[model samples]
Target: MAKRKGTVFGVPVVVALFFLGMMMPTSVGISLGGLRLSVYRVVLLVMFLPMLITLFSGRCGKPHLFDALALGHAALALVSLIHWGGLQQGLESGGIYIVEFAGAYLLGRLYIRSSEDFRALARAYVVTVVGMLAFTIPEALTSVHILHDGIAAVTGGAPAPYIDQRMGLERTFGPFDHPILYGVFSASAFSLAYFVLAEKRLTNGRGMALVLGVALATFLSASGGPYVVLMMQAFVAGWERVMGRLPTRWKLLWALFAVIYACIDLFSNRTPFHVFVTYFTFSTVSAYNRILLFEFGTAEVARHPWLGVGLGDWVRPVWMSDSMDNFWLLIAMRYGLPAWALLVGLMLGLVWAVGRRKGLPEPWKRARHAWAFTLFGITVAAATVHLWNALFVLFLFLIGSGAWLYDARLPKRIGQPPRLGPPAPRLRPPPERLF
Candidate 1:
């Protein structure tokens, strides 16, 4: 197959629509049979069939372990929903859940089939975050969510309120429902923007400027979770660049963390995780509540391990709010440990799988590094905060998008001789190139 000519708008229609839909709040959705079909949900559902068809066409490549895990997670969610809510309501809600989860995954799997496609995705990601600054900046300064407030004015729905101030600035919610969600979504593009764009295409400091733009947007949210994500991305990027020469650098890094964790667990008054939660947070109260939440939340998961409290409240102190801040724990508390495991497994498994692949050109190598590290940041951040709606779908979409890296084989040179092995399967041709 000839080298694919990936354009900036390679996945133009769906990618554009996906980001555009996300810019609108959930309040701006159509009501169909008691189900509020949000903007992004509609986009996913509309494209779900075509994406599914493309996936099964063997166009991308043979399915991998993550593919099975994604489908299995969706299936478990459907079954759990039915088991909890009676057949009609269960199917209604569960179907949307599948659409959000599996549908988003398939879109990423089908559209991003090569390094060029991945590049296009990365550029789109950075562009989207940069464009979001117009509203986020004003929202951060004014403490008024401009986008949501405007939508609420017309739709007669309540606008998103200003979150608690951090560092004397109101947390910027941007177009998302929460400031943390906005920050998490924006922070994801940090590694991609820096590694993919700044490292190669925009080497003249313009790329670094773009990365700072993304960083500024993430900071505007002023949320702990997003800050953690930003810090992790920076750490990963630095570690890889400085330690790329050492073969056992990763193992050494792991051992170092292990030793630190052991020392903290043994010597500190609080457990390692508790200490981690306490120090990483902006507010002492939040840290304390999160610790308490983990304590109570895990107990609830233990009580209802099979099918979690299913839209029902988990047991906690009367003074504590019903919200579960931790996304990973919330999954176990709501859907059961199996569901949480499958979802997490799909994420970390793909990151590990793609990271292990070798012999790629600079672009592909950076692409893998960017995607893997981005997920690493999100994985740790999720422990500190919950993701929902657009952010949740986006999280899965990113995981699916990286699936291409596992099977990708970019030519080392223009006319490199074929390797001594069975011929690699031909990649499905990309769609018409669009800038």
Candidate 2:
């Protein structure tokens, strides 16, 4: 066999494979004994095999801090096990969380190299989401008919599961387990597509068309989190644009003032604000459960403020409730303050990186802005739902990758040109002078 030369495009290809794998149906295969393996899982395993082989063969770069994030998550799980009581429960809950995040970290590190790689990955994600939405919209509309037929065929009866009051409007789950997951996925996809369209280098009529289609899908999903994210993204992008026209000092001051106001507002209106969110934003079940879970989680934090109830032990008495809806509360209940601090630190670091490099090349800037919007959206969504799943993990990876890229391309000084030297000589030197 000949030695293969590694190509630059391999990164994006790997990323695309991972995203496609994730988006595949979970029930696309059969169960072998107790382990239920799906086509999607099998494909991801196969795709990962090559990357593993390449890594062992010294063809890939060493893992960076992004990979460390996965390890940190694992460490938090370990800590939870020690604090809670047993490893079994931790393995069941926190273990799954760790695996999801590890997978996301590995995927992000696998394909991200240059700004072009980022764009390609983002494009692939957008295409997959839009394509899924296009295929599923009609299916969702006709789900009642399809469900009726399916039920009749199985039971040979007139009454069907579709007509049963248990199931609401047949929501198109696509490859995911629920319509809410689809909604979150669409929201992130919509944001990324918008960013792609906004980028000067990548924007076109095609991109705009895709963005509009994805936005419609997001609206249809009726997932309030994504909508909130969209609004926040718009505000941030607009703010950035306005900041660009102002002096650097004024920009800094404006940012500081905004932060101060946000802090004040957040503290002053926590109860009524949360009430408004519950009333207006979430599904009835989600809103009710989230409130209960948040209360339980907060109490758990108060009791075990130091080590937490133990990582993955949030389901225990103090922290245990029927509803484990909020991601932040989940973190607080499972990992305690230290783990929560680490997660918050990571998020803040990403935000700082994005804010610092507000002015960059087109795709790079868009990537950062999109990431900021996604994170903010995820945070809001987390209040109503757990973000330990594939969608949230992917969103985190995107934000991290964007921050990494932005920092990689940051200008050397606050407002100075990247290079301090005089412009390159326009005329070429004579061959003799080249010596």
Residues 11-95 of candidate 2: C-alpha lDDT, one tens digit per residue: 4544555565556445344565444444434544455556445434643455445345546765775667655767665555554
CA deviation > 4 Å runs, candidate 2: 1-11, 28-70, 82-96, 144-170, 198-204, 241-244, 247-276, 279-288, 310-321, 406-435
- Flag clash pairs in model 2: 80-311
Error of 2 at 327 (Å): 1.0
Q: Which candidate leads the pack in TM-score?
A: 1
| Global fold similarity of model 2 (TM-score) | 0.72
Q: What TM-score, computed on C-alpha atoms, does each candidate reach?
A: 0.91, 0.72
